[model samples]
Target: MGTTVETGPFGHLAEDLADLQLPTTDAEEWRYSRVADIDPTRFARAPVEPALESISTARATIDDLLGASTQPPSATVVVVDGSVSAAEAADPVRIDVHAVQTVQTEQASPNAFALLNERLCSAQVTVTVDAQARVVAPIVVASVVTTDGVVVAPRMRIELGANSEATLVEVHRSTGPSDSLVVPVTEVEVGRDATLRHVLIQDVSVRSDVVGSVTARVEASGTYDTWIAAIGGRYARTRVDCQLLGRGADARLVSLYAGGGDQMRDLRTFQDHLARDTTSELVFKGAVDGRAHAVYTGLIRIHPDARGANAEQSNRIMTLSDDAWAESVPNLEIENNDVRCAHASTVGPVDADQRFYLETRGVPTEVAERLIVAGFFDEVLDRCPVPGIAEAIRPTLAELMSGDRT
Candidate 1:
């Protein structure tokens, strides 16, 4: 498995990553984020296993965070330090769970950090659903990293068969010192006429560093919808690449992010269209307060043959403090003329008119600000594929927003 001549899917990936340097802020994709916190060469390749006592405590913490009782998942896969602790699939939902040595990936990431993960990860969890099967309850996958001064890379692959439908709830959390790095890559393949709903919750602690990516390929008449609710981590960055590769495919991405108290939140997105009659839309709304920073860069590219493609990208951020900063860029490269496209970005303080109107109604200044911030995130929260995700985010958002929601 260590050599470049192995005949496997992930074979030669390490060789391809050999001699690659870590990306600095000078690179276009890494322009505004701090990557040093999670650099692979700066930390030990092997992570110290989390203690059983600590793991028991962490599992209890996760159960409370996800409200496992109310939103009881049909299947649950628990991953700790790059290994799966448990994979549970209930009755009536036909699904296959397995383990693999190395995963061959067709989507290559531009960042060396991701390749470093592929080179270092030890295990992965693979989930597959049969054709035409509908799994009503969601599948919950939790990833946790517990030791400091080390690297943990977790791999996940999801395969949905033709005309199948399901939902996945992914939670990433960490409890470590400042130098801990958790790099997790997830690959999803959606089959023809299938529907997949994905909800990603990044709820790490304030001292963890995370560089994560989700790559998905959608087939004809398939629908892939995703929503992200990020609230924790000291320096965090996530990327999403959606490839609409078949006719009548649709993809939608909606996210809500917040960074406070010197924390930094960065996100990158790409929507590449390769087939006709494909549609894609992305809406990201966030806030930065207490001298924090947030950065967003997105690209929408329509191939020459995708003449009937339609795509839109919108990113809006509210800077609640004078010390807060935000940067956003939306780009598009179209080789075809018969397509619909729109891109919008904004970073500013609360709207004067809205704030003033609330204050005119006798609302206090702090309360008015909270109300406005809550309203701004509501537009996308209303569209979350899993209602429980929005409910789960309220407490964190409220705490970060200064008692905004119940």
Candidate 2:
């Protein structure tokens, strides 16, 4: 049933490939997902390319992807076609680019896509912050895909030392409208008393597909905050897992996504509390237009030792067209009676009362609806830790709302 291989650098590629089995829609984790539509055999692994020669060229590429209005980052790492093309950093930050032939297959991956990513990833990039160092500017990582009918996997790890403070921005973009698959995985470790703010922006071509994963662990008295904006891709999905492993850990998760035309946006999250007095809160909001679809499923679990833990999860969706569809499911599993957990989810159209109030104040019906949608997203956008991301996302949201509103 399975083949086993020795563990080493670039070992067991053939055996791993032989045992890889793609997930199906029947699986609980894959339920309501478009996993069946994906044919991994259709795409080939990305070809190796030489790193960019000039720092100026790398900076220009980053600016082009992030937009001109974004502030200058303290450090920048650019990955193209799963390889580290360029890396630049300022003080108090260390950037390491490792060229690896293959991923260590000792541990099994969460899913087939993740396993494929592990096997095909071209390089591993790590960013480290020194202890107690407070960085004022954000560190930017730009992962770009530039080929068609090819698969690209990018792996990144961020480590924060004890009592350190930093902000990071990770973005995914395509150079052109290519029908490709991109799988990216990110790992984060927050040391004791450290604070980290992470902002993820996915704006790939609508012709491509993306499946990404993020995993983070917070230590005692540490805080981790993340904000995600998913605006592009034909079929885009992201799964985030955050664990509070030490007492007094805190986490805040916020996301905003918009889908239009025939696109599909899927998001899943898990908040795990394993220690006493830990807390976590999540808020996700999305809107669908035309025949687009959106799905969000989140779970908050508290372990028996997680006494006095408080966790909350919420997901809300708005449908702007009759043909659009949305699904929101929030769940909680608590083992300790002393812990407090609550979950809420809603899927519907614009609020009638809010629309009526706006129209009664002389705003046109169309303008009232647009305003309502804008106001609905602003609640989550306002919480974004990055400065220019929210500004750049507003135009996209506006364009989506400008479409036929039912």
Candidate 3:
């Protein structure tokens, strides 16, 4: 193997990760994951700064990537191939490029991809909403990957000050059918009495793979709400860890995913209640078709000090074809008797009764199945934090059901 000559702010991380090995399915955290299939060394890292012509091209295509929307964003930050190409912000909000910072978390072990992202990312983008500020429009961050045979690491940090309220939209897309790797890491800090609504959309090429991580901390009386839509990629996986660190903190997570044609969608989540009166709720739904596979594993842990904590988790999946496969696992570890926690998971095909009802109502078999699938995801899509996300995804969902995804 050739040595990697590292350079940049995290250049020294190469030494620390020299002996570290990539995760395998043998580990519980990596079970059902395709980590063994990936060879990180085969892909080169993106340049520290993208070319001016590349930036112009990205600018021209940004609108098409984000889709048409009626409302203009309050702030916009565009990252092309892991480098910041354009950024603009409104009042009381700040956008920083190439900000060097390390995330501190106590709940999860060191993730190999996350560490690699920090070391190899061309730039780190930071968005901050000041205290007591209220932003009616959403702040949009678009991470675009356009090169093939390369690895792109995108890092994002969101900080909400006390008593502030804001909505953030993050979208990941690949401009071409590139066989590449994308490793992204996001860190969120919700301050006391703050409310932050976050939405993430992942729509990359089917020839590519993605490994992403999100870590968040909520302070006293703070609320953190997030929605995730995983619709594209050959093998797409995401892990989320949320810690309620102060009294009365609340966290809500919702996710929707669809897999087709040998694709795989894997999601893992951890809800940790460490303080008194903390609360959390999670709902994830997905469908697999045409020999595709889906996996959902989640855990809710209530610490001894987390008195009066309440937590709920639910994951449901539908298999559209006999060749498709899915797995759902939900667990709870409570150390406090005063806490209330419940978890439920189900893996099965579309409800026969619902399909029959639709068919008996004169709906065609294909149309009935499509309607059922759309209605199944409507529960989660209706709650999307972003305005146009649901509308944008409806057409894609229709195409997936019709096997027209290209």
Candidate 4:
């Protein structure tokens, strides 16, 4: 990458890496996070190599997790240990087949993972979806770890055609009993009057740290719905930024996170109103236990031209254990006079009165806690427009709430 282009794509990334200053837990934004503990030199780069040897092996694992059958692609973008293959094209779809790879790139921020990604990421890819065409089945973007001390950086860019639509499912896993880092950045552009629905299910693991972010731009009259459910990862943070660039654009951001066993998950969402009559809403629910912690920050910004815009955001968190922790912050910046905006946040333990009521109703303590937690998330899960996702999430939710199943 040229100096100008590199600086243009990632402005602060270059400067931060050059300074090599570790981010502290003191910064308000970084208070709950610290990356210096992870020795940077201990993580070796894993390169993207040929997939001929692991093609069958990779497909088997995918089938086992997804519980479905599929045909093997003619080709793939393979990253073996922290490097990119000379024979592989950065763009996977152009190969006329399914591509698999691991990569990393510099992000435009000083956030712990983003800064780490700047210096450690070796290979990256950008996936593009053409206009007007539709992809029926779920397109799986798999990132599998090979070595224990290996770190991988993978980037995916998805573009939807003027009226095209598709479903993408991203799976991140490690091949061995090593501490792996996977940083995935996804950029999506929804066309005018188009509809895009994205479902992000994170099962990376409590031992892994997954920093995934996506920036989406919606055209006039377009609709975008995002569903994010996180149940694993030692420290997983997802940032979803959506810009309503055209009039009547709409976006719905919903997230459900369960942090257990000392794990922490942080989420930040931004909704930008650039056009008139645009609308957006954000709803997040979290459950924490076993000394786990969860952080949520949301923002809604309306520009002057975004008159008649309507926005509403709310976050509610439930603490399942005495040691668990939760924090929620929602901010709204309005520049237009003819707009409606509101935000609300709450963080606390399950009500004793409600718990006692459930216990008196012949429900065991464990079952009562599960019921309360289920009800807490059910309000948002019920809104999941996709039919099977809600039912599919019930068992996972039960596992976290009951602490019995994995």
Candidate with better TM-score, 2 vs 4: 2
The estimated TM-scores of all candidates read 0.89, 0.90, 0.94, 0.80
Order the numbered candidates by lDDT, best leading: 3, 2, 1, 4
Better of 1 and 3 by TM-score: 3
Model 2 weakest 10-residue run by lDDT: 1-10
- Candidate 1: residue pairs that collide: 9-104
What is the model-wide C-alpha lDDT for candidate 4?
0.66
**Candidate 1 Cα outliers beyond 4 Å, as residue runs:** 1-20, 45-49, 90-107, 175-179, 402-406
lDDT of model 2, residue 375: 91
Residue range 1-406, candidate 3, lDDT tens digits: 1112223542233354566588999999889999998877777666656678767666655566455666688899888888787788967888887644786655668889987787777678889999999998888998888777777888999999999999998888887788888988999999999999999888787788999988989999999999999997889998889999999999999999998888899999999999999999999999999988999999999999999999999999999999999999898899999989988899999899999999899999878998889999999999997766788888877776566776
**In candidate 4, how many clashes are counted?**
17
Task: Give the per-residue lDDT of model 2 (tens digit) for 1-406.
Answer: 1111212233223444666787888998889788888766677666566235433443455576456445678888877767677788866888877643333332224677777777777777788999899988899998877767777788888889999999999988776677888888888889999999999988777888888888888999899999999887888999888989999999999999988888889999989898999999999999998889999989898999999999999999999889999999888889999988888899999898998998899999888988889899999989988776787788878876565211
Residue range with the least summed lDDT across 10 consecutive positions in model 4: 1-10
Candidate 3 TM-score versus the reference: 0.94
Residue-wise lDDT of candidate 4 within 49-126, one digit each (tens)? 525545445445445555532433222343333333321222223312223332332323445555555455454444
Q: Give the count of colliding residue pairs in each prediction.
A: 1, 0, 0, 17
In order, what lDDT does every prediction score?
0.78, 0.82, 0.85, 0.66
